[model samples]
Target: MQYIYAMMFALEEINNSSTLLPGVKLGHHIHDSCSLPAWALQAALSLVGGDMPSCNSAAKYEEEKGIGASKGDQPVPLIIGGCNSVTAQIVSRLLVPLSLPLVSYTASTPSLSDKQQFPNFFRTMASDVYQARAIAQLAIKFKWTWVGAVVANNDYGLMALKVFQEGIQRAGVCLAFVETLQRENIVSDARRAALAIQASTAKVILIVAWYTDVMELFLQLDKLNVTDRQFLASEAWSTSSDLRQSTFSHKVASGVLGVAIRSSTLPGFDTYIHNLNPLLRPNDHFLKEFWEKEFGCSPGIATASPFASLPPCNGTESLWAVNNLFTDTSQLRVTYNVYLAVYAAAHALHSLLFCPDVNSSPGHNITCSFTNQIKPIELMEQLSKVNVTTPQGEAFNFQGADITGKYDLVNWQSSPEGQVQLVLIGLVNGFDLHLNESAIQWSTGSSQVPVSICSEACPSGTRMATRKGEPICCFDCIPCADGEISNTTGSTQCVHCPSEFWSNAERTACIPRQLDFLSFNETLGITLTAVAVSGVTVTIAVFVVFLYYRQTPMVRANNSELSFLLLLSIKLCFLCSLVFIGRPSAWSCRFQQAAFGISFVLCVSCLQVKTIVVLAAFRSARPGAEALMRWFGPGQQRGSVCFFTSIQVSHYFDNLSFTPDSVHIQWLSEVYTYYISY
Candidate 1:
């Protein structure tokens, strides 16, 4: 309906402008195709003057006006109709023999690009080849690897399906299912397609069908309460009012992803649509039906024609108060195509008459001549070279067999009041696509695009491996092997670490594997140092107590010299542990090991000497043990401690003699450095 109103507006604008087509009035015989090829074929035959008698009468009238005629009169100068590709193909075949110029607004099938087949046919929209690849690219951008497809069983659907199948497969996306919906028995076909869509595992579904067929599927999906799935729509129904105007369908179509021909504001189009007077269109049956449906009122003398249930018209209804699909200017992608198509036809006629300068053609130049002798075939040649500026100052041309145009990607998002709107989220020009993901909304009302993957993504430290006989979306995650690293999620394979580095515990990253040694700042090192210092403090306190009670009987009986030697050895043991606390240098390594061994041996030897002296004194009470008890004196006990300590000292020098380089000697072979140094 918007397209029809747009065409009417464009023609009116051209006729009212005195600068363009001076002394020439352009008129048209419009017909509704009803989206059927048969109806379109009938209209095409009528455009060539409806048979021989009508043609002869027209030719006779032209002869009476003193004009030469050739091959009888050629119908109207041009035709603009057949919005769909299927209908346009049928209508173009009939109009080709008569050499009628047919300019279509939205017929975008690639099969029509052949000049031999559709030479007289041209369109204002881009071909379907671009649209199919754009759809596949959009799915890949969102990582929607698995999807379901539903196409109408027609030429347009089949051709688009083939192109899209190749495109998606090239992008590595797998189809979960492909269903078809036919125009005849649309109700049953939509139900079956809906069942297939529901049974499939894909969360995204693509529909390549007309608006009417899509409406039927929407009805079936509504019955099943399937509102959470995502949709990828074709240009055929992506911006249709039939789906956008209904509250129920809009709810189900919320967050619908699709492509549409680019559209812009047309300044006065909204006012023109709202101010349309139905009373002035008394001869238009379609306008009457629109009035009846929009206002719930019927024309006068209405009988039982299924429209009788509507309230009778009082002849006073205002179109301004009826807000309906015709008034919406928010999505005018198709309407803009119609507007440009009309201007293209008008510009071709202006060129044929050779008008100079549309802005100043009244008095600046002589008016071009026009006669009935000029044929429609000559007008088609002019249309092929038509180049004119649109009302918005944009270029409109049909120089080539097909026009390349831009497509806008829109998402249906819900408002706070539950109304849905088409939000522009991205665009495609030629083969390049630019998407702003932040502007999109999902059916679940989430700002994030819902995940449509068949499996969870593999985490870092693991690589994805294909599962046998399954789709690409289904895969396995395997952990990286030793000496390898997988730093990214969903990595295909692991990377090997360098020789000087080693993998981290999780194997997600690598770090330098230099010789590890303990430092005083670390927790383990600090703990060990505190314990050794505490042991030294206790030993010093015990030595001071014994020195204070040197003359006491108990102190004397325990041999004061041996006790002093034992306390000194214990102090040396604690002090020697500090040599291993710092980094292993030449002096620290050699002294740490030698001092620790000698100090521990001295402590044990002094204890052994004290035990033997105590037993000898007890045995001296017997008469024969007096000499043996004398030999085990304090000097003898000291000699025994010295002899044992000397053996340890000798062993330390023995290891140093063999190695010769103190720095090369590892303190605990550098492996236990972390344990012993701390």
Candidate 2:
């Protein structure tokens, strides 16, 4: 009823304006669709066929002008009706053959955007494509990775669900459940959807359904006592007065974040609505019914009226005294759309009737040459190119068959009086979302945003390992392996460090490896150095003592030359062990091994020569042993020792040819074991 009033208001506003369509007056024939596609289709057929009942001012005007004298003439040039997508689609298909333009105020199905399918269909409200993307972006902005969905079985809900699913899938968000609701089975479907929502772990649920369907769902949800989860609403029922006035609105709808069609206050619309009275328009049956329903009074004393049981109307009931959907014009969203649609039609009609260059001469009087019968096809062509601005400074134009989409992000917050208040928290234009999160009132009654995810984010030093048979969002945090690093949080894989670098203890970063070598400053190296030095010192002292006692009888008997040589060789062996204690270099490594081997062989060879001389001396005491003493003289013994020592030196030099310039410190243990066995 308010929509019809808005259309009438626009028509009257245009008719009174002298600058636009100066001599022409626009009239409207309104029909009640009862929110049914069949009724809407029937009404459209009557308007196009000129067989409509003469119950409105438009029919009276047609009768006065004899516009319907011919059966072929189309009395209605255009139509603004079918507030929902299903009815809009039905009406659009019926009007296509007649080339009649059908401008809808609120039918926002994305399928209607196809120009080939709905060429003559134009709408003041944006299509559902933008609304779906806005809802998807809202979920992503809040980082709600896991959410449930409930959609109506109609074109508006199903089409929006398709688009929204596509968007969330691209963003890697997972749906915990998807439930569909049909008007025929709304009660059962709503119960099922409510149960699904209750059983799911998702803390946020998206509902893409009409006002009536959502109301039923909310009733079921309230019965189930499911008030903890937040709801994301589509534009269909985001600002629905019926839903807001529902008994369970506060319990189920509070803290709901939704996208609503952009709205603005229509100037003078409030006063115009307040002044409505059935007595002023007693012939208007719809207005009479509206008055009867609002004030609980019948307009006339007719028994055939549905409100016949009610009290008689005084014809003086004030609309301003009653606050209802009819009189409340504060957020005139759909009403403003109706106003725009009417203006658009008026502008198109003006362009078709009045041409600027029909009389070019200044002396000639400017007049329109159009007939009283305006063609529907011609009006449609003009409507396609219609562009105008509203009094509130908003630019209005059509992008293809629909206007550009712009929405207000609203939150259903609890007011101080315990009523649900639709608070404007953001704006959504195209894919861009400007949100004021600080102003948001959450369902938990706290400042913290709700968390909806399958798993927590992986911290640094770990990578995300996806769980089997689950969504990507459900993952485990696995620490990086040794020699690998994951510096960033939630890394998919760990990267191997460079050759000279190794991972730190936490495996979060790479650092240069420390050199592994025994040094003299360390405890083990110092102990080895002291032991080697002591052995060298004691051997040197023994060599000196043996040399000092060379003329003594005991020393001479013991073969003093061999004994002094043995002491010197033992001293050389002890000094060579010191070479193994410090940081190894190319020259020190080769010299250490060669010196140790050669000194060890010379010491053992001296011992053998001394034993042989002792045997020779003992044999000289026996019969016929004088020759044995001569054979094992000092020169022979010394030669034998020198020969063995020289052989060892040659072998050391031979091995040096195959050895590397610098041995790895890691191989030092193996080298020590091999030389100790020798």
Candidate 3:
């Protein structure tokens, strides 16, 4: 009813203005659609080609004033009706073949944007495409990976649900369940939807439905006492006053986040509504019905009136005495849309009637040369190009058949009186949503945002392993593998560490591996060093004793020179072991192996010489053994020892070319044991 008044208000404002549509008056023929697509289509057909029924005051006034009285005359050049998407679609399809234009105030289905289907359709409201994107973005911004959905079983709800699913899927959000509500079977559907909401683990639910259907669903939800889940609403029922004032508002609508159509207060609309009286327009049945319903009185003079049993209306009943949705003009969203729709149609007509001629001379006055025979096709063309600035200083123009999307993010908050209030918390322009999260109030009466995810995020040191046959949000945390690390939470995979680096105990990060070497500070190094030093000292003492006894028969017979050489070699071997004890460097790594190998070889060569000399002495008692003694003399023994030792030294130093930055402890221990056995 307010929507009708809004259109009348805009039409009245336009007709009285001399600057626009000069010396021209626009008359309207109103029809009641009853929110039915069939009725809306019938009304549209009657306006275009059928007879104008004199059922309302506006039609009678047009008839008596001869504004468009001829039987063949097309009184309505354009239409501004069909509030819902289904109605708009039906009427537009009917009007398209006849070249009629329709400017809807609130029909916002995404399918209406198809120029091929709704070529002559223009709407003041933004399409559901933008609304779906805004809702999806809001969920993603808050990291609500898992959520439930409830949509009406109609074109509007189904289309919005489809688009929303696409958007959320792209962002990796998953739905726990999707429930559809049928207006025809609202009782059963709402019960099922409520049960789905109650049983689901999702803490948030997205509801895309009309006001009445949503109201029914909320009633069921209230009966079930489902108060823990937060609901995300579409523009259709987001700011509906009926829902706000419903009995279940506190139980089911608290902490509801919604994307509402952008709205502004329409100037003079409140006064226009207050000044309405059935007596002034007695032929208008809609006004009488509104008056009776609002004042709860019988305004009809007939005895068969439905409201005859109620109190009689005095025609002086003030509309301000009662507060209702009809008179409430605080947030004029759909009303403002109606106003824009009317103005757009008027502007398009003005452009068509007073079009400037391209062939006219410069500075010549453009004439307003238009008859009442205006074609709907020409008006549609002009409407496509019409750009109008609203009274609130906002400007908009049609991109194709729809305007750019802009929405207000509203949250249902409880006032001090326990009434649900739609609080402005953010704005969405196009696909971008600017939200004030701190201002949001959750269903739990906390300032914290609600959690809605299938699984908790994997912490650092772990990677996410998705559960089979489930959504990506449902996952398990697995510890990182050895030599791998996961630095951040919710990591999908672990990264292998670099060769020189190794994973920490927690597997959260990579760190340098410990350098392996036999250091002098450890117990093993001290024990080995003490033993090596003692062996060298004992060898030196034996060498000194042998040298002191060089003149004795025992010393001469035992080959003292060879023994001294072997002692020197044994000292070299013992000192080489020290090279392996400290932190290994390039020189120590090369010299340790070479020194051990050459010293051991030299000691073995000297022992061989001593053994041969002893055998030669023992064989001297046999005949012809003197020749063997000469061959195994002191000079020969020295030559043999020197030649073999030189060969071993050269071989050991020649092959020393390998170097390493660091060595593993296990590998170093194995190499040390092998060398000791050798």
Candidate 4:
């Protein structure tokens, strides 16, 4: 299934950013969303001399937290989330008088964005009303005259259902019974629960319960065979793997109705996926080669997105500005969107403070770098209306109380081969955005080559290649188990595949860490030592092969691109076999096994490439001899690399640049100074 992964990205851009007035090394403090009370947050916004916190206090509070400088001199700006409406409502009230900003990624409650009451609230997603309208239209399309509402007892539920009711009425749908479900009753008797819901005369049941409850209700209905009514849902059901798995799920929802803004249909989504990692050059030469080899496709593999405007985190993008370290996150965009939302706050603070119209009273502390005071309305009024491209691509300009944006609809389709494929089913361009890519060949729901991540699962040691679920749809890479590390995503192997399993050439998998001694000690340690020793000896053997059979089919084949790759694979397998000699973990573990699989695949791939190359080369040689080649095979054939070690060593040892620090620093300096990187 297309995983709708969510998490947070923490950005620390404020640490290095400066205001119009200089000299203040920006100090920051953060609180777990888990326990941030209203009073504490209120205390956070009060500014008084010597009452606010200081950087010097960081060392003092290294282990313990520093209370607001008893006087609360510094006003702390906050960047919170709309994971739920209660917190958003609370933060909205707490922030209004403080002139502090509360930017929300999903606070679509409409009231928060009112500007009159909560003048400091900012939102990026469509409001519940907008979603309600979309759902209403979908309901009308199904000609659902009588629709039932099974809503949760939460703020999101209440408000969302209200809006949905209004929209449905506006769209000419009859008012079905509105059943409010309670959180406490989720585990209650299913028969009683079904009876309660059965009272709704509407044939279609649309539940606005919290995500967890919606799925649970389906299960309860399944257990009770409560399949008389048709099931309708929302984005909550879009990516749930279990929803479609229940026994009565399909029967209850065989023609279920729902509303969702298919992600792929959104403008810039495909491009964002193609260039997911903002850190990588969209058109890099070498990376393209490695990327294609690792994941079969090269789009959407960047470290951060241009849409995600946050501080770069040590070669990666930390989505939020927590007081200290921030983790990679993807909210709507796999939770990391939270970081993008936070980073937007930092950018706003920076922009407003630096705006020429911005004014700061004299006598402000040199330590207090003033964040320009602008009401949310004023800030929204002044900020550029043009769409700002962020790495996350989720943060968008406020659509003026109405969220109007394109959405993509796709479903995971399984082929006869049992391969799960994400197929684009429809595209709705509500806001009319012209995309820059060719992936979305159909706009109004047509089967085209839509953007997809081919389930090219990056192994365990390798975490997600992009933040858990950046638009790319592929798995990420992390360092493999048992130590060793790589600096990029979707690595070919884990470091140190252990003793029992021999590490493959790519290190993606490991073979049994056994020495082919033919006659030796049977102990594991001795076998491992033999394995490591064998690895060294094997490298020597490959070198010898180059020296002697340097011209044999096995060696001469290295001349052609495919043959060379095959040879490299064979040699790598041999070298990896030696890994058993160095180390081994327990048996049957995926780490070692994965390494072996990768190694074997690459080796065989080498052979395949060689076969194709040989066929091409021979066909070209036939030339126009009686024009047979013209009729069958004849052309100026061009072939590329084989990565054959013996031949590649010259390119690697002599020309491949290894000066990383200099290269990176120079690159960064160039981007800042000249607006470009060479």
Candidate 5:
């Protein structure tokens, strides 16, 4: 979103900066394209001019009009625009014949580079052809031998497809297939597309559509259970989430592979935009808000067409520099250096206008001022040769016959966790056409893995493999299991293991969990036996005390306790706790702990009641007046304690008796107990 702001800011700055060149001081006007494709066409044609005139017999005609007089029919002769590629084509065709200079700031379709057709047209950013070659070169470096292409049927798509095809052919790779999809076609088509590509045996497929389309295509790929294929995308892939996360994540999470020009993360980009627009904010919001407030809509590539030629270099930071340089410059900078195109054409026309050439009216000085003498198409050939250097230090010379400029390539692979590991494959000097043409292997490592990236020997357990007489594919390494992690990029060994599968944190290997031993061990099993015997002793001691005090009417009436209630309640709760602790099954492991907590709480409550009753009987003189305490008496509390103790004592045995399947009731009668009394 911020990208739009920087683009608008570039146009604003170029339109605002005054050129110190001593001539007509540059005055600037702005249009709000609203970033719409249709509006972009309007802004381009409107700013650069919709029509041009014939350059034939221009000299005698200029001489009759005096200084700067030829543009009398249409006074403003300079032009720049057609931010959309279609509009640029229209404007380029319109201006090419008469040689009116036209420049586009953002329309980067490869067709505009046609020297014969768009002789007068120029652009600051690279064309799609350059981007295509860069991506194809990246694919070659990855050792991919075959590729598929998915493109729209538009001019941008066609141009991108042509250049990509050329690049792949030049790399000695095969085109597996070419499929076309519409902007609106969804998963059904994507499924068919992937299936068809799979038939081609292509490892990587390139998409020329929007990122959302790419994401949808991949989601459908997952549904097809065909995630083995790789992917390559254009500059349009930057805003894509799948690509960004895939770089450092294991590929299994999402199958995606590609090379793309990510905008440079230089801090100066924001500063550049802020200097142009003081109320700095996010790129899109600022652009939409400012353009809407000023021009009743948001601004876009079309609105800035007049000054497209000023920002020569379209780097990550150049947008900001553009906005600051041409804010109020000379007429040339204001309209994509159209005046300079005039500056160059006026000089070229010197032979025709003033020199003793076959057509010239000799010694007649037609005013060099291009305000009117030059037609929009007259400068087409000459403008192509001009090198625009903005005050912000942005420079561009679009003389390259083929695409490909400065593009970085990174080799990527996926790991088990669904993360992509982007290994720095190597930086290719794509613009270095000399090395590539100098020899088939002139590059240090051809296009894929440059020989200069690394020279160290690969560690053991991994091997080096190359693809199709070119770049290395990957360092093949064996992966360790779930308990381990890899800390280094090329490490042969796995790192620390997590605790879920280990007795200790150290993860040499996994060990089996030990089942219950209390069922067989003498010390543990016998100790439990002794504890049960102690419970019996406690029961006997309480019963003896009850008999010793039988003469007391309080003791006789109170009764020691409800033996049946104690046995029934304790047995039921103890049985449930035993079922919980006996097995490690999911049901038992999670639910048993909760059941035990409730049972223990109840047991403790009963024990507490017994102690309280005992104390109340010892202290109170009027026992009946104490209500439940005096009326029911201290004996109830004591019996509650016995009830609780009985429950707690049985729990110890229950816990120790746990096994992998004690609650295996189907086998319980046959295996868990033998010669049962009950």
Candidate 6:
């Protein structure tokens, strides 16, 4: 209805302009399509004269015209709209064979771009391809991986669904379910769609339907108390006044995010609506119906007896009391399309009539001559090349059969007073999509963006474990393994640490491993160092005691030299343990094991020599070992000790020559026992 008003408004502007098509007046017979394809077809049939008489053929019609040829018969050169895709498709099919140009204000299905099927079809609205791509980008940008979809059972819904499905999948977003709402059974279908939405876990829903379809579905959603889901509306009815004006729209679609056809504010459209009266537009024909609906009254009835219950309009009723959605000039996207559609037709006709030889002229040798004829085919050819700028400075042009227009990103937000209205949040043009995230309101009524993922995001230090038979978004968070790390949230795999490194407690990063040899500050190292020092002191005390008693007869009989060597070797053995007190280094690795080996050898040798001396002394007393006693002495015991010490030192030097220069320091302390055994 807004489109019709815009079209009529443009026609009036053009008719009143003395500079445009001078002395020629443009008039139209308007039809109410009632949002039905059959009604649209009926409207098209009425324009083509309904089997009355065969009008001039295309060739005969071109030979005669009021503007450029001898005045002669001609059919209506163009038809201007059924405002939706399905209706446009029906009307295009009915009027294409008759060679009538069908200029649509809002029909935007991409299939209509095929010139072969719709050669006479043209539109002032951008194709659904742009809108679908824009919507897919929106979901991807916000990381809304899982969402539901509800579409009407018609060409617009099915085509938009297919387009958006392909686009979103390419961007890695998945739909929870694609449900359909049947206009024929709106109540049942809406209920079923609402139940599907409520049952699924998706918090976002994409609605690809007309304004009326959206209204019915939202009404059902409100009744079901399903108001928490965010809705993504297609360009078809994204900024529809009908939806905005609906009573249940606020409850159901409070936080709708959608792509709307771009529009500039039209000046004075509000004043134009407010000043309308049946008395002024007596010839409008539909004026009576408008008066009846707006004022709730009859127009022609003079007496109150016929319609006593209703208020009879005095033709001075103010439309300012009505809702601003139907009166405001803001967000006139669809109305702008209608305005452009009329201009496209008027410009094409102007080119055919008066400016045939201008830059928009067709083919070779054609010139603007008053003798050149005007026809529907010629007007269509001109419309395909029509390029002009709107009064608001918007570029108006056609790319093949599709118009190039912008899509504004809009969000339905609640004002401080709790009234819901659309706020411009972004813009989408060509392939670029930008959004202002902070300005958007979510259905959750929280400051944060509403989450629509199938599962919560895996935090850092964990990797995702995808659930079987579920969407990729549905996953479990598993901590990284002992020697691995995951530093990013939602990481698919954890990385293993290097050989000499270990994962931190949180598993978010790797750190070099601590050196493992005994250190003096540790409990075991302190205990061992204390014991080793005490043993050394005790051995020194023993050596001193033995020296102090050397002059005594029992000490003199015990072989003092052997006793001194044994005490010194025991002291060296206790000191060897001190080498293991600090972090193992090259010097400690070589010295700790060699010192222990040599000390053990010297102690054993001293014990062996003492054993021989004792046996000889006892046997000699029995009178059979006199020769054995003569050979055993302190000098022999010293020689024995020296021999064992030399052997151990030689073995240590030989093993050290064959060992690698740098050993793995972690294993050095444990190799001390092996050195002794070897």
lDDT per model vs. reference? 0.75, 0.79, 0.80, 0.46, 0.46, 0.74
lDDT minimum window of 10 residues, candidate 1: 59-68
* Candidate 1 residue pairs that clash: none
Best-fitting candidate, measured by lDDT?
A: 3
Candidate 3: list runs displaced more than 4 Å: 54-74, 169-172, 296-304, 308-315, 356-368, 518-582, 586-678
- The lDDT, on a scale of 0 to 1, for candidate 2 is 0.79
Off by over 4 Å in 6: 49-75, 240-248, 296-327, 356-372, 416-418, 514-678
Q: TM-scores for all candidates?
A: 0.65, 0.74, 0.75, 0.42, 0.42, 0.68
Better of 5 and 6 by TM-score: 6
TM-score of 3: 0.75
Superior by lDDT: candidate 5 or candidate 6: 6
Model 5 earns a TM-score of 0.42
Worst 10 residues of 4 by lDDT: 60-69
Better of 1 and 6 by lDDT: 1
Candidate RMSDs in order: 15.1, 9.9, 8.0, 34.4, 25.5, 10.8
The regions of model 4 sitting more than 4 angstroms off are: 1-30, 34-76, 170-172, 188-193, 196-203, 227-229, 241-257, 261-336, 355-387, 391-395, 399-406, 410-424, 428-678
lDDT of 2 at 417: 83
Candidate 1 lDDT over 627-654, as tens digits, reads: 8967876678778888988987887777
lDDT of 6 by residue, 59-124 (tens): 111000111112232333467775778777777877687777888777888888989889898888
Q: Which lDDT tens digits does candidate 4 get at residues 503-609?
A: 44444556674444322345775675566567657756666667676666866555543444455555566555444343333331223333433455555445544
**Per-residue error at 589 for model 2, in Å?**
11
Better of 1 and 4 by lDDT: 1
- Which of candidates 3 and 6 is the stronger one according to TM-score? 3
Clashes of 2: 0
